[model samples]
Target chain A: MTRLGRSAGRRPSSGFGDAPEVVVEHAGFFSHLVTRSTGRALRMEIEARLARARGAAVAVLDLTHVVMIDYACADEIVAKIVERTGQGGARRVLALLRGVSEHTREPIQRALARRGLAACAEGTGGRGMLLGEIRDRENRAWEEVTRLGRAGTARTTEAVARRLGTGDRQATEALETLTARGLIFGDGSHYVSVAVMARADTSTASADDE
Target chain B: MSRVLSVSPELDHQAFEALVAELPDATRSGVSILFDASAVTWVSPYGLIGLLALGREVEQRTGKRPMLEPPRNREVSGYMERMEFWPAAQNVFQLPGKQARRHGDSGALIEITSIRSNEDVHAVVKKVGEGARRILQGRLGYSKASVIHFSIMLSEVCQNIVEHAGSLGWACAQTYRWQRRLGREVAVLAVMDVGIGFEQSLGARNASTGSAAALEAAVLRGESRFKDRGRGHGLQAIRRQVLEWHGSLRIRSGAAMVGDIAEWERRLAAGAGGEYAPDRVSVKTGLPPFPGAQVMIVLPAAEESITPGPEAA
Candidate 1:
């Protein structure tokens, strides 16, 4: 089984120098998430592990091996995690979902949408997409930024505005919305895809192996 | 002193009323009850679990576990034993002599089981997972995706006992060839609890006149006692899945029963003077009060047939 935490690699610092990433994979532990009790237990376990990772650590929840997830379990596990991570406070964590199959994604998406929240999902091909509630313009901005990596010439807000055919202020708000939702990383001048950051970590691990 | 109640010959949703009408009133004193099943020929999953619920209620109220006269027909007895009905009945009914243990090669997709907590719900889902897939796809000819949806429906119904019912409940599922009712193979799921029924569960938030109104609010309206947005999605999910498969979902709580009757049931119910809404959901109020709730879901066999196989186990 392709475990989520194992794919996190040992080099958490490779992608975002200061902040580390923790992967919480329950595929091996549970074959099905059917009830709220199991979901709460898994969420608590994930929170405990993420707590140790300290400031602004990104948490990836892998659902690859989970054969099924019901709505109650999805609300407790996925929705609760996203809600807690999106809370306004210092030392906040970010949530990302990986290895979500088409069968298991609906309940998770419904759970998130119920709470009026959103999270980034790492697709099978390593690209990131938003799941749950997202504004149309904000989604477009996220797509544009993920395509324009954070390296080399920094793509400023104005560049994105011109690409989107929208005003600079509108573009800025959209990018900021994406940043606030933790779908992408913003450093005042440029935005980077969380998926890209994860990919970089994988590349760094492979290079070190060689 | 003891009272004898005769079990229906064909114990199913249609005969459920007759079975309940035989019950001693809830206020009846400590009089031992003997459930005579000597003439029972067949039992649906709903009837199987409803028997346990009824027995438990009588035992709890009268402070005496009711006695059961097992069905005399060999096939019916064998079928009940294979469904693990005896083991589950031991909890609520007093039986005679040594009973047969459950065999692995039974046709029941999910056996008589308890649903008290989330762990119990998880266990039921896991136990039925593979078997449900095979039966749903191979026998009922559902798509692969429909298998998971079926599991979700199972999980949600069982979870309802834990989250909403104040007490424990029983769940059972089986796939049968309904030669008389529909002339097709249908998967039946039944769950029942002698706990706080829909009236008390939803009356706290949504005002309703009676059990029928409460059931309608919950099943048809998708209302919940909790103010939380996701609290009521389970029933909605069940309703949607049943609609997709053109299945029937019937729920009875307190003094009434409500259901989105299937086409076949609608015609049968029409013959019996059942007034239906434009959407085919029918509600009956002012029924003899029964404690807790009873749910029955029947997923009719696929219209398109490919191959015939052995029944689900």
Candidate 2:
């Protein structure tokens, strides 16, 4: 399937069977470039890919074509970047985002501020070490939460606390927070992890080893 | 898998933490806890803060929040309101029923007519329970335990209608919405009956007693005169369950308003206890102009759990 066609639920037409990657080209306006459902799915797909990237040295999120942005999609994208980059000793993410509105860009910058990824600007050419550190830590933190959630017992608060290295109160509070955010769900005794939010898939720039 | 924890009236911070600690990790991370505070008429700030801290910890670990179920006990709601936690709780959980409605704004009007046969009480309870569960699930995504608790409270209230409303009159349930200043959702469930009101319900046992005394007695554990007959314990159970969840309950019978614990306490302290008297102690009042009783229940959304860090001293 073509990149855009793959996203909107179209089957692969021909010769594209070997293309494991999906890429969506951006149009000028937000509505034209990203629909709500497609935007969400894209964000999830990006995060999933990053998770699977494991210990790769660099992860590139190329968004350099034309574009407009919605707040929800923007927030999700920023969160993913911040989270992925925050993990220690993980692959650094180099975003190739272009034509981003000032309104959308400011929040993204602020989110990356604490992570040391703020110094790396769009189209900065060559790799930046600070960005890599931030990306690695963010990814590690996210992986920790996911790993703990998957391995922890779902029936009792104590089990969750132990996995997270927190007290019962903190564990319960964290559970509450996660539930509100729609990251996890529970049966009587156990919790099931749901898919993370996804935005759009973009063209791949070159893979970089920092 | 369905482990039940029966907390006593003497629940302390340590005991509460231990109970929470017993839950499984995944359940701890994802489960939505509903605190039924109706039974707890009074709460110390220290205890309340401890609970809040637990809720916070849960959120930080799992990144999910818990929903706080409103207590049907007026005293409990009053206590939460005094602590300024009521509005925050409502905002987080998005309370169900009457409190869900926007304050000062009216929405769809639903009228529920309860057929006053003792046998139909169960059916009515089931119907109300299903409706309530659907609404709550849609709004707050509560757990099965929370839904079951809600069902229990609804069933008890319906049972009261069957036993105390003279077995013949119909009870009406109305749904309304009013906007709250805090932007927290509020839905109202008002159940009214044109039967023997609270005065008569209580007076049937004692000729000179008022609605306040009957309400007080009804809510207290094991205070039912009909304990042998299997009728009065429902209200007490409802009161307890509601308080535990953090909901509010208001009852009006004849010229008497008996179920609002906050109002009752204020009046009693202000020396208005003797002036406002009812003729009977039943769930209904037999007065001519307004001959029935109306029970208005306000429930907040399920509560979010908090997990405090070990470093928190």
Candidate 3:
């Protein structure tokens, strides 16, 4: 079970409900991330913060303020974190990139693609998009979930299966795959997008192994 | 008696080989060498850094500072001084008289700077980034994105010296007007070191593979001496960006050189019957054995600013 503990009595103004999301704002910390050593330093700081949070927490890496990021920094920070997050350690931290720009996205994409890993990023209009490798079925399922969010759907397996016009088993497999990759979170029978998790009220937010 | 070697009139990438070829074998000990640059009329960034490396090599081997006869041409000497060459050279060359004071409009985009650690690389980027907007954007017509790429490229090249060379090195950049030939401005960047080169750094098995094969493996195939996943991407990315910009890049280590020669350079080479026509394998090899690596990058002006010169007719 995933329980949120760091609720600082502050509610998110984005109206998606205040989930106890750990936001690691990097723009204020670094002007640019260009070298391997600098990347390693930032990665360690992010890892330390993730380790402090309770089980199965979603961490938003806000890159809006960073000026530039080179390949070394991208590989050292983003790729390493994605690789480690997928390892399913005692404390699982899912990463969601926020405020990625055209200049910074290329290196991040290349870094993740090289390792055959993928991470969810906040796209335009607060929707979620995959940044690295993804299969067609997985992508379709993710798109369906985000599409349902347009109408305030709960993103349950049965709802996704009805939308994809596929049977419940295939849809369940797709959602489960996304959840395993940390692109989405599974709560018993329903899946929640990271976009929602970033704002969901932690008092009611609970993710289960299913 | 000290050995005397005359410097080439036009010091460049190709001339560096001729310079090194004049050195005595590594086994010759305790014989101080004198570099007579009294006749050198012009020098490229490669030539400048290569001289430092050569001086360091001689000093380390002979345990005595190499004696350098300053260039006789006042213009050449002035150019060197303004580029901050004398300050760096003081560490490697022994002058006969008082060191000349440097005061002038330095034509260099980035002055000769030593690369000993990562902080040096950061300083280079910061120093160059300040003036790169005016030079790369205003003169060369490079877009903002291109300027950023150039900074990253510069950072990676300097990092190679820190990460791979295992010794000290120097880096410099200057803008040159190819008025007679290309009628365009090109930014020339050179980075050189006196340390373990590709053949030794790659591993024991590659020790005998020679510099050409090792350069080909590293630059073209992106093979690194390290087995890490992200290792060796710098050179490959540099090659791609240089090609996309229609520029020229050459790397020389040990006794061989490998390069992506631009079309204009190839034409000039063919016209002059130069050894670097890219037609023969031996052309890239058979240079005098030298330690460490020397890299040269020439980025031409963007297409909008390019125009054929009188020589083109």
Sort order, DockQ high to low: 1, 3, 2
Task: Write down the lDDT that model 1 would get.
Answer: 0.76
Candidate 3's C-alpha runs over 4 A off are A1-29, A122-128, A135-137, A146-170, A200-210, B26-29, B101-107, B204-208, B274-283, B304-313
| Every model's TM-score | 0.88, 0.32, 0.84
What ranges in model 1 sit over 4 Å off? Answer: A1-29, A52-54, A125-127, A151-156, A197-210, B24-29, B203-209, B271-277, B304-313
Residues B224-303 of candidate 2: C-alpha lDDT, one tens digit per residue: 44323223434554555555444456665554455433222223334633444222122333322234555656544543
lDDT to native, each model: 0.76, 0.40, 0.73
Q: Model 3, B65-121: lDDT tens per residue? A: 888998989999998988888889899999887777678657577889999998898
Q: Name the TM-score of chain A in model 3.
A: 0.75
| Candidate closest to the true structure, highest DockQ | 1
Q: Score the docking of each candidate (DockQ).
A: 0.68, 0.01, 0.36
DockQ of 3: 0.36
Fnat of all models, as shown: 0.84, 0.00, 0.08
* Clashing residue pairs for model 3: A17-A199, A18-A200, A18-A201, A19-A200, A19-A201
Interface RMSD of 2: 24.3
Q: Name the candidate, 1 or 2, with the larger TM-score value.
A: 1
Pairs that collide, model 1: none
Quote the lDDT for B151 in model 2: 46
Residue B26 in model 1: lDDT: 31
